[model samples]
Target chain A: MSTTTLSKATLSHLDWLEAEAIHIMREVAGQCANPVLLFSGGKDSICMLRVAEKAFRPGRFPFPLMHIDTGHNYKEVTDFRDKRAAELGERLIVRSVEESMARGTVVLKSADESRNKHQSVTLLEAIEEFGFDACIGGARRDEEKARAKERICSFRDEFGQWDPKNQRPELWSLYNARAFKGENIRVFPISNWTEIDVWQYIEREKLELPSIYFAHTRPVVRKAGGMLPVTEITPAKPGDVVEDVLVRFRTVGDITCTAPVESAADTVAKIIEETATTTITERGATRLDDQTSEASMEQRKKEGYF
Target chain B: MSAIENIPAQGNAVDNGLLRFLTCGSVDDGKSTLIGRLLFDTKTILADTLHAIERTSQKRGMEAVDLSLLTDGLQAEREQGITIDVAYRYFTTGTRKYIIADAPGHEQYTRNMVTAASTANLAIILIDARKGVLTQTRRHSYLAHLVNIPHVVVAVNKMDLVDYSQERFEQIKADYLAFAAKLGIDDVRFIPMSALNGDMVVERGERLAWYDGPTLLDILETAPPAHTERAEKFRFPVQYVCRPQDSANPELHDYRGFMGRVESGELAAGDAVTVLPSGLETRVKAIELYGEKLPRATSEQSVTILLEDEIDISRGDMIVKTSELPNVAKQIDAMLCWLSETPLDPRRKYVVRHTTRESKAMLAGIEYRMDINTMERQPAEKLAMNDIARVSLKLAQPLFTDPYVDSRGTGAFIVIDESSNNTVGAGMIL
Candidate 1:
């Protein structure tokens, strides 16, 4: 440790976060018997892939990539998900909500009901099918209130339920990632990262994201205080005010439940600038499913939602 | 109190690295309000978040917008008006960022407080001004001290309740200082604040004319990151071994890397190192961070280390500087905080995960248990949840370790129940 090398001693905030996430990802590879990266082709998942590359790159990732698709997500995201996985040469496992519905494990309340919440069931079924001891996700604490209380290696029951009251007391970077038969651990490598941190990392790494993340012209209808993109599944009804507006998604989720905020920030650098000064939270701005109640996220999480 | 007289009126421009601190107190002490004020004054709270809490406060028929509601993250916590678990909050000043771990004080949640205090470089012990120093204040301070946090900021909150009296602030400061000294807590600072009135938190209000100390934001911003201010022995625990056998690339053919984070101290590319358990000495050939090579790496930065000579090393192995080796032992005497409701069963063999190493440990003896209120050691036959006790463990295999005070990275472990696979206790090596 010379005086000249002292300048490299303290890392920037993004480096610290990237290093931490890489550590967590390696922990999963070192500890878990069977693990899978839950990729949605979203920004957070893309960030996870970059960290996974850093953690075990030159070598293949210890686990494969899996997706629990809702069948109604943005085509750009699903297409990017497949493209990224193929380019990385990693095995990609796609388990669809439609397949779950075909198996009768997931039943829709109505023909037009959103398949957002039912992704949990399909996710659990995929875990059972693959016997994945750990599923690495990209959920961050800063996204919502209940998420802020979750552990880095969030433990779930045999039925994939999260217990909010009783969590493994995580100390230091030591993650308790042990589970029994039929049980699994959902690891959020970027649990400590904020939305702004994610964007800054994306800008630093020059990571690619789906087109919907940036501003684009889309046919959208404003309802319940959220701008829902007009898709075939969620088209504008008779009394709906449809407008071709410039918008970008704050969070990418199911088409029926996820909405986009009005934005013209098209680049990652612009997104970073916008996120730094934005007055709205990531979920509150675009997640229509979160509008029901403050505890809705908690309830969904308890039933094994990532 | 000592640093108060030395601090300038307008504080220094802290251009240091990131700082993580714990703010521990109950709801009544305005701990939430203090945190909320810090976030609000920093302009870190988004409009929708504030609006949501504002709507909730309006529903509850509160007047001043109930800033405390901002910190109530859980549904049950919001209903009961208390922090049930450790909730993380973030904000950034102009120079650096902050990560605040908000842990509860009212409940018998020593495990929660320990979780929050584990990674904190500093701890904020919030004391109600009118009440002076209470039992929980000492308990939380003891927890911070137990974790060996470098700094402690004793915030005398609710100063307005005492008519903004400097005498009241001094009395509480003296009272807390005595306990802090008894608990062997060094680097303690004090400030009088009214979180409800937004005084001496992020701002230097007009009411606190007698008090002259750096605000909480100032201290947090300027505080050095863990293992940065002092030079410590380097400890790198091997988390994973990267051996890529791809025939397509020549670089992947012979690559064998020991991947992990620099848990403490620092390491460079040409440093002499030793692999533990085998006790083999080697020199670092290179330090690979993704595609780039680093001349040196500091604590908390994950990197892949390639040795000059091929030595047998795997996960759970230790890579240390050959000059400063840690103690390797089979028996450990530790201060154990049992975190499970099932209590400790002497007949059960628990797994001790120290660093990356895992070994079976049997409870040898329970020397004594701590009584939180009395601050006394009592003889106990069995250990229960939230009980801090002196316990001896017999490990199935030897582990490379150090005293918890010397380096937290090498001296701490979590006890996992072999049957349930849950973390049963947290132990710090004596």
Candidate 2:
């Protein structure tokens, strides 16, 4: 490449966003004492992995990767998650809602209940377990109303709750990751990156992602104006017709709650093009749990959900 | 597909994924109202939040539910119906996610707006149709441009005030275009809407049938976010020096890595680079991300770099590709936007924190004051709050830098009043 080729190189907005995200990841690694990357094996987390690689590839990262499992995860995602972590030769730590429940730290009203909200208990326990001062996440502002209210370095109380009212005043690019004991900071590296940015970056970087992100023929049943996968965990109800449809997940959450959207855009490039004309916000299209009054994002963040 | 029974009840290693964004505009322009509408319409508001807005609106004797009440959370702000602090509101869409920094619209709060927009990829600039392009609008636009925010959405609000006329929208659009061109803002988008009546905001407006474009929500969801990586000049300001103190980890103990984020450009191991301020030279031996080593590091990625030689470097100094070195200087001229409540005193000295470096700056001389409304420049001796003027400054030490327009990460700095310890002004290198 020519040295003075400022405009010649094929550098898109997505590339810049990825580079910025990677930089943020490195900053977290360099600045924080005990940093752990929160990886859910979702598209956003997949994008964060690419950033982490770009930020620190030839060597191992300073911190290990962690996940707060809601016990109701998709088999495809969890299978791909373990395989990818093993392939990279990186440490992957997991804390489960099932364990939290067993320990009596998390209580449920029903045995067949959605364990999505209970993941917060496991997350706080994991934070305390590792003494993690900074937990890097792939939560995008464009995803949820409460995530939008978050600062890049969101401060959480000792109890792992987010008080939006008591956020630190972030001036310029000077981020104060400083916190007292037991109070960890949730650092969002790609906080500024939109959903489209994540997809585009994924495509441009040729990052490896799980098959669940792409469109596939799946047996699903329509419920709550969305398609819920006909899994045993969230089986088809009576009077519901299970049909095979080409669908893709805009976001990957608990298998029982995250719905799939009807899409033929199987490739990353196709997803990018489809994302360009998408009118419905990403969260609006795929989350079965988010379609209700009880599982609002703002409330989730306040209650210590990522 | 693996059967749910066959699938292990495994939660994949949790990765923290989140997003962030910023919103800007003046008070009367309905900036806060737009945020309120987004939160309200999206069903993100809780019963307590609704009750609070209702109580506040009722206290103010409003007929309808005041949506702006959701964002204007300060006592003085609610009383005066103005946003003073940067009110952050979070909401999510189905396809993706977001973080909205609702910044103050008043000219005096430009510094606060700058602080908010500094880290934002997209900026939504609200424009009141009745007022067209006001001085505050220009200042906001200029700040957006100056800060190098990749996208700008000109939400021309209060369309109902002008009877939702396309002609008025076109005129205001033209006026903004003319002014924006001077500042070199390329991706300027104009969206005309009545934030109050829900026109072209969340939903399409029937009145704007002549105009065909996606709603504000549509644009926000679809607009290309600013790209982060590409072939560009590599600029890294050392923020820390990482060397393990433990002798047991021999490899880590002697590992001397200069850590910083690539402000712009791609860098590879073995790329010849130079240290700024000292003008020393070195080549990248290795790049570290966490404990892993990388062959390359690009713009915006934060990583520690090991050099071929042990060069004298610290937190304030910068590392750049030797081929693209910035000019080093002690004296410089820049456009200053006074941000303090206290007036500017030429004799008073303050610290200028630029990039990752800080230096004591003395006011050398004032050149001219900028008339934001008329876009005119006039000679001035002193600047008060919200005043934009060209000023010459002499630094206590020579610094390596570039013009703000050329390199945003390296060219910008903020003036801190040593007495009150508040950031008094922000400046762009000229």
Candidate 3:
């Protein structure tokens, strides 16, 4: 038998996390028949894309890239999404809430209402149309209280509703990706990663993102202790005063509900420095729709929101 | 050694090492409170979370801010005021990052505790000071050891209720040591703490000056790193086969790579390896990680390896060092932790998933079920949910495996129900 003496290699926590994520991606590809990676051009999804590259490179992904377009999203994010997918030469599938609304599957209370929550209906319809067995997402457990209670391999019913009480037991690395027809599983490979970890990985990997993540001058109105971007979907109220300020988004969602924080951190290094001392979480400081108990994350998750 | 020497000065930058631990005990043993205190003292709790918990406490007609509300995120858990499943909590101090698996303390949730301990490096078993040691405490300790967690911390919580008595703490520690000795656990550390009063959890409470030892935070920071437990031999289970036949990238055509994460030990280029179940020999031609070639791939790194010789390999096949071939057998004697609601029936067939290999298996015979409380072996007919038993299984196909004591990555397997596709039990090869 031939053997070689090699020096040991020490891996950082981020390396371990990346390896675990790649393993999970491979497992999903090996197990699931029809799977799609949900990419929103956000930081988390961008990290997921990088992990997918490491998992299977020089070959096309077994699954396609998908986006649940709310139709109220920021132009920068959607443009970046298209460019990133095109650069990878992978097929991108975009299903919009507008299409669902035209079909009468989604009905908004007001014309100017945020279509973030309504994206779930469109998402479930897309899953039904595509016959996807698994939808890989970038949801982290440390993001919110409800997400923290979710399983890494969260199983969804035929209606795409989540039953947190009846989740399957995920022990060790043996995830049960079994789902009957019409039932899908939402796989979160980065469930163990935190916001800081994501940022650290981004900086280390030199991942590109939309410009809105960095500090930029933009017209915004202050409402509910958060800066709401002034856009056609969300215009200023009667007494609201809009101003230009240097701000950045801690999280990017629909332009109607997502808020920006005042920051001068322009580079990834500066953003890392800012995140280290930040006292407030990403969602608490930014998301407008999460301010009330009625629209709690748990309630939304039960309604098929990712 | 003086306690003050163990306590590092405030605001020291400790290495950002990762530590995963489980907190388990009987219900109402202050397990949740201890985790809450760790997060609160480490300054990981956000201002909004603190305010939310405070408002929830006030609405519930409580005098103090209930820290347990921070972890009990589910609505049903809040309504019942108990953790029914494992809730993972993440926090970081200047020195280290900790992942706490707050396992449910109910007796029936032993499966939950086992799930948490499966990946844990350390375990913090809470023992109520008022109650020296309970049956649940022993059960949690045994589960922790069974999973091969290297470190064990016996936290005597609710010290304030016992008047911060040193004698009481010593008595409990002595009793625990005696019990732990029977399980062959040596790295047990005892600390007296009050999860409510914040004594010796994060800070050194003034009342425990007479009892000199590192605080819970200090001990966690100084505990041994988890990577020291890797197996001594290289073990890699093939997960996927990567072959890109893109015409544009002609350099990659006909490139066959066996992709898998190194489960244990290390593999270097030119090292001879054997593909198990087929027993075919091959030498490592190259180790590629994301388009970059490396001299070696160590444990826990996912990489693609090209062999010198063409061999028949697929998913569920094992590629290990030729010198360290593991047991390839069809019959396995192992310890089983039944996890499903339905009891294990020896007459029925179940799918055994070992590493990436899946095969049909059935229980040959159950040797005995150990009573967790008394450590007694009792003859059991069927293994119920949360029951631990030593049994023999006959597999439809041979598997390459190591004993659970030798390598955790290669030794453990899960039993899945064929009809429901639910994981019904976990086994460790003896």
**Number of the top-ranking candidate, with TM-score as the measure:** 1
After superposition, candidate 1 runs with Cα above 4 Å error: A1-9, B1-15
Candidate 1 interface RMSD to the true structure: 5.2
Those runs of model 3 whose alpha carbons end farther than 4 Å from true positions after fitting are A1-10, B1-16, B227-231
Candidate of highest DockQ: 1
B1-430 per-residue lDDT for model 2 (tens digits): 1111111111122111223467788658888788877765555555545775688689889989888877755334445666656655555454334557788877666667877876677888998899998888888888787677878889999998998889999999999999899978989888998889888887786888877977888877764443332345678888766665556556665667787777777788899999987889988998866566676765555677899998888878899999998878798899888877688898888888776677899999999998765678898888987788899999997777887666667777788776644567878888
Each prediction's TM-score versus the true structure: 0.96, 0.66, 0.95
Interface RMSD per candidate: 5.2, 9.3, 4.6
TM-score values for chain B across all models: 0.95, 0.86, 0.94
Instruction: Report the lDDT tens digits of candidate 3 across residue range B1-430.
Output: 2211211111223344567888987558888788888888777787888888898789989999987777877777777777777878887664556778888988888899998998887899999999988888889899999887888999999999999999999999989989899999998999999989899998998999897889998988877655455446899999989888878888888788889888788898999999988899989999987888878988777889999998988999999999999999799999999999999988999999888888999889999998887889999999999899999999999988888877777889999998887889998899
* Candidate whose lDDT is highest: 1
* DockQ order of candidates, top first: 1, 3, 2
CA lDDT of each prediction against the hidden true structure: 0.87, 0.74, 0.85
* lDDT string, candidate 2, A51-135, tens digits: 7765654456678889888888887888878987888778999889999999999999897778898898899999999999999
Taking chain A by itself, what TM-score does each prediction score? 0.96, 0.93, 0.96
Candidate 3 chain A: 10-residue stretch with minimal lDDT: A1-10
